[model samples]
Every structure is written in structure tokens, then in C-alpha cells.
Target: MSASELPYQYIVLRCVPRPEREEFVNVGVVLYCQASDFLQAGWRVDVERLHALDPRVSTDQVCAALEFIDAVCAGDPRGGAASEQPRGTRFGFLKAPRSTVLQPGPVHGGVTTDPARQLEHLVSTLVG
Candidate 1:
């Protein structure tokens, strides 16, 4: 890797309407670059798509979860104690597996100088 490139890791966030059936919709992405001290999240909710998967899914709850991701990434007080940790700890917390409507896909890695742009690209390609 060139000096201009920095290592980063990311996870594609998923909205699992029905965990028992294992059905999910790609919703967002969280990315962290330690070298650059960058952490951010980008997301979009396709209400129509989510409804098609499960008409009973609560769009409001899904959106609230996504907002929490953003707040955590920004280290905002609204994110609660999780946002108080260091950036790396915050990333680990977000990526940890959990049984919830909003779930992390898997950890993926790559090199990029611009973590923000890479985050946008990941969200567009992986979540869209």
C-alpha cells in the first residue's frame, strides 16, 4: 500500500425484519480508520422495500436505530455512554454482533486515503 493509503475496516448494517426467517435488507454502513482517526456512518431506509419484506416492520424504530449509529460515530452525547469511549472502542461496540432489528453484517477491510468517501461508496454499493 502507498503512503497515501490508510487501513480501514467497515461493516454493512442490515435491517432484519424477521430473524427467524433470516430475511434482511441492507440499510447502512459504519466505517472506522484508525490511522486517520475517522469514524462515520451512512444509511438510508427504503420504506417500500422494507414493507415488501415485512409489512409489520416499524420504520420509526429502524430509523431511530440508524440515528443512534450516526450519533455514536460522531461521539455525540445522544449516543450515550458508548459514544464516550475512544473511537476504536466505539467502532468495536458498533460492530459487535447482536440480536436486534439493526444488525452488523461482517467486518471488511481495505485501504483508502479518504475514509469519508470510502464510507459513501460502501453504503451506495453494499446497502443500496
Candidate 2:
């Protein structure tokens, strides 16, 4: 990678209505570039798509969780102590595997000169 390009890691956020069923709907993305001290999250919830997976899925809860992720990325006071952690630590907390309605998918890596733009691109390409 060129000097201008920085390595970044990201995770696709998913809404797993039924973990037992092993199904999920892409709801958001979290990205971090330690080299550039950048971290952020982007999200969108398709109600129709989520209901199709499980009629009982709670969009509000999913949204709240996703919002928390965004807060953490932004180091917002609303995110509490997690947000106060170092950026890399916050990213690590987010990318850790979990079994919940709102959980992250596998971690992926790439190189980019603009971490923010790459985050938007991933949200469009993978979470859409």
C-alpha cells in the first residue's frame, strides 16, 4: 500500500432476529483505522426486510444498539465508559463476536486513504 493509504479494519453489523435459526439482516457497519486515528459507524434499518426475517423483530431495540455503536465511535458521552476508551479498544469491543439481536459479523481489513469515505462505501455495499 502507498504511504497515503492506511490499513483499516471493519465489521458488518447485523440484526439477528433468531440466532437459533442462524439468519440475519445487514443493519450497519463499524470501521476503524488506527493509523489515522479514525473510527466510525454507519447504519440503516430496512423494516420490511427485518420483518421478513422474523415478524417479531424489534426495530427499536436494534436501532438503539446501533446508535450505541455510533456513539462509541464518536466518543459521545451517551456511550458511557466504553466511549472513553481508546479508539482501538472501542473498535475491539465492537468487533468481538456476540450472540444477540444486534451483533457484528466477521472482521474484515483493507487499505484506504480516507477511512470515513471507505466506511460509507462499505455501509452502502455490504449493509445495503
**Could you say which candidate leads in lDDT?**
1
Q: What are the TM-scores, per candidate, against the unseen true structure?
A: 0.98, 0.97
Candidate 2 C-alpha error for residue 61, in Å: 0.8
In model 1, residue pairs whose N, Cα or C atoms come closer than 3 Å (at least 3 residues apart or on different chains), thus clashing, are none
Tens digit per residue, CA lDDT, model 1, 48-119: 999999999999999999999999999999999999999999999999999998999989999998999999
- How many pairs of residues collide in each model? 0, 0
Give the local distance difference test score of model 1. Answer: 0.95
Please name the candidate that would achieve the greatest TM-score relative to the true structure.
Answer: 1
- Candidate 2 per-residue lDDT, tens place, 1-128, comes to 99999999999999999999999899999999999999999999999999999999989999999888989999998898999999999999999888889988899999999999999999999888
Name the 10 consecutive residues with the lowest summed lDDT in model 1.
Answer: 119-128
